[model samples]
Target: MISVLFAVLTAISNGSASVLQRRAASTVPDAEAMHLSLIRHLLRKKVWLAGIGLVVVAAVCQAVALATGPIAVVQPIFVIELPATLLIASCAFRVRLSRSAWRGVASVTCGLALGMAAAAPGGGSESVPGYRWIPALIVTGVFEAALIIWSRRLRGNARAALLGLAAACGYALTAALMKDAVSRLDNGGGVLALVSAWQLYGMAVAGVGALFLLQNALQAGSLVASQPMLTLGDALISITYGVTLFGESLRSGWWLLPELIGVALIAAGCVELARSPLMTGAKPPPPRVR
Candidate 1:
């Protein structure tokens, strides 16, 4: 129960941090956008500093949650972060959430609950063998490298979306590795053991890569495109890793019907939220009557 609560806290902190960082990142100079020097400037901004603080808080919460809960249970809960970001942005930016936006929030909420419940994901043990890690890590690297190369040739929202997706993959892998490492720590591996573990090193690199991609995504275009891709992409990929790496499972044999339905609702909701005025900072589309 505490793990669930910690996961919720992680979601809240993560959602709020995204909004804050986006708001702060917008003020950054265009020339410095993709450069390493940008982080220096961002660190000087109070808002960015605050956002980083929240991110630290979020990471702590997530680590605790992963230690105690199934990766399947902990990670999908992050999908709600999209709607949470919208809500936080609406209040902080003083933007209005239109009727459609509220509807979208409700859709995401119900969908998340239904999907997670219907999925009924089961857990795995701490001892993931070395053989499983080889293919998984290789595939992850190749896919991310491909995404980076492809996105580099594009511009605007498309590039942002692709980069966000890549970042999502990185985060998913980081979460999985974190779970494994934490499990190791729980099962008698001390801090010294963790320092020597390859998963710990892998998680660090992946975490940095994810943050790098996220910053670039924010700079490239609107959160409208990037947010959903980041949210849904991470959730889905995390679910896959849970089953593959961590030996987690989901409900099947006809129970998949509701799972599919829930996925549909989540897609619809994220799309609606993306197109909303609150997220895009544009006027709401005109209501057409038959």
Candidate 2:
């Protein structure tokens, strides 16, 4: 339960960061997209800096979540990020959520509960084998490279989706590495062992890389295109890493039915939520005197 609580906190923090980053990123010129100059532009924006601060908070929460529980249980809970983003954006824009938006929130909430109950993710190791990390790093690097290349050929929403997915992969890999590194703290090594671990450094590199990719994704298109990809991609990819790297287990056979259904509901909810006027940057209705 501690894992779930921390994971939820992480999601909220990440959600808030995404909204703030998106605000800053949207102002960058199109010519700057995907270039290092894009980051330079964002660096001057206080909103982006605030987002980065929240990212640090999320990272601390995530480290605790991964350390306390199975990665399978911890990561999937991040699917709430999109819904959280919606709520935060609505609040910031001084707009009321539509009925459909509320429905979307309900669907996502129910779906996550159903899927987690059906899948019952559990029994993962604290540490992943060193040998496993080599292939994971190689494959992840190749995959992200391909996505970046493909994204460069597109514009608007398509580019955002691809880049968001790539960022998701980076985040998932970071989480896995963080788990491996953080586990040392409890494994008799304490702080000295954690600091000495190569995984700790790898996590930092991956986290920074992911942050860069996310900024580009935000700049490239609306949240409608990027948020769902970022949210769902992170959850699914993280689950894969959990199972493959840390040997996490989930229910199977008949349980797959509810799990699949839950995924469908979550996806549908995400689509609906992403299309909300508030998320799409439509002008909020003006206040009227009563």
Candidate 3:
């Protein structure tokens, strides 16, 4: 129950963080190069500073949740951020999602709920060996770097998707490192031991990289394009990390079928939402002149 509470709190903070960051990003000069100067400029804004605070608080909540529960359980809960963001955006921007888009939102909400309930992942090792993380880090770093480069070669939604994917991978790696750090706390490591651990440094670096990618993804295109990969992709990757790296296991055999169906529903909903004009604040096309 404590883990569940923390997961919900993480979702709320993360959802609010994204909305605040978007608000801040809109006020600043648009950046395409993903430059450090962009961070400097945003730091000067009170709005962006507030967003950063939420992000920090979110990170704390995420760490606590991961420490207390399986990554599969914790990360999937982050999906709630999408619906929460949409609700907040609607109130703040006075924008309304079309009825069809609302259906899409419903599908996303339902799929996440059902999928998580079915998977019910369990049985994870308290700690991962340092050597195991070496291969994982190298692979994740190379994959994310490649995606970022690919994103740079594109424009518009394509770029946003790629950058979001990169950010998603970085975030997953950060979670894995975070889980490792938190797991060690029970072994008499305490806060000081976590501070001294390599996983802490890895998590910090990965988090910074994820933030850079997220800023770039926002600049590249609409939230509709990036949000799915960011939210859903992170869940998928975190599940992978939990199973392979942390010795966690999900209900297998026939249980896999529902999980796949749930993923399909999520993907379908994301596609519908992405194509909605509400995502970009663009007016719908006019009726034909006949």
Q: Which residue pairs does candidate 1 place in steric collision?
A: none
lDDT of 1 by residue, 1-290 (tens): 87788988888888777766776666667677568877887778897788788888988999999889888889889878768878887787666677888898999999999999899987677557878999999999999999989988887889889988998999999999998887778878689878888988889999988988888887777777788888888888999998988888899989899988888888788878877665554554555557
Q: For candidate 2, write residues 178-228 as lDDT tens digits.
A: 999999999999999999999999999999899999999999998878888
Ranking by TM-score: 2, 1, 3
Candidate 3 segments exceeding 4 Å error: 26-32, 88-98, 271-290
Could you tell me the TM-score of candidate 1? 0.89
Write the number of the candidate with greater TM-score, choosing between 1 and 3: 1
- Please tell me which model should have the higher lDDT, number 1 or number 3: 1
Off by over 4 Å in 2: 88-94, 280-282, 286-290
lDDT values of the candidates?
Answer: 0.83, 0.90, 0.80
Instruction: Point to the candidate with the largest lDDT.
Output: 2
**Per-model TM against the reference:** 0.89, 0.94, 0.88
Q: What is the C-alpha RMSD of each candidate to the true structure, in Å?
A: 3.4, 1.9, 3.6
Arranged by lDDT with the best first, the candidates are 2, 1, 3
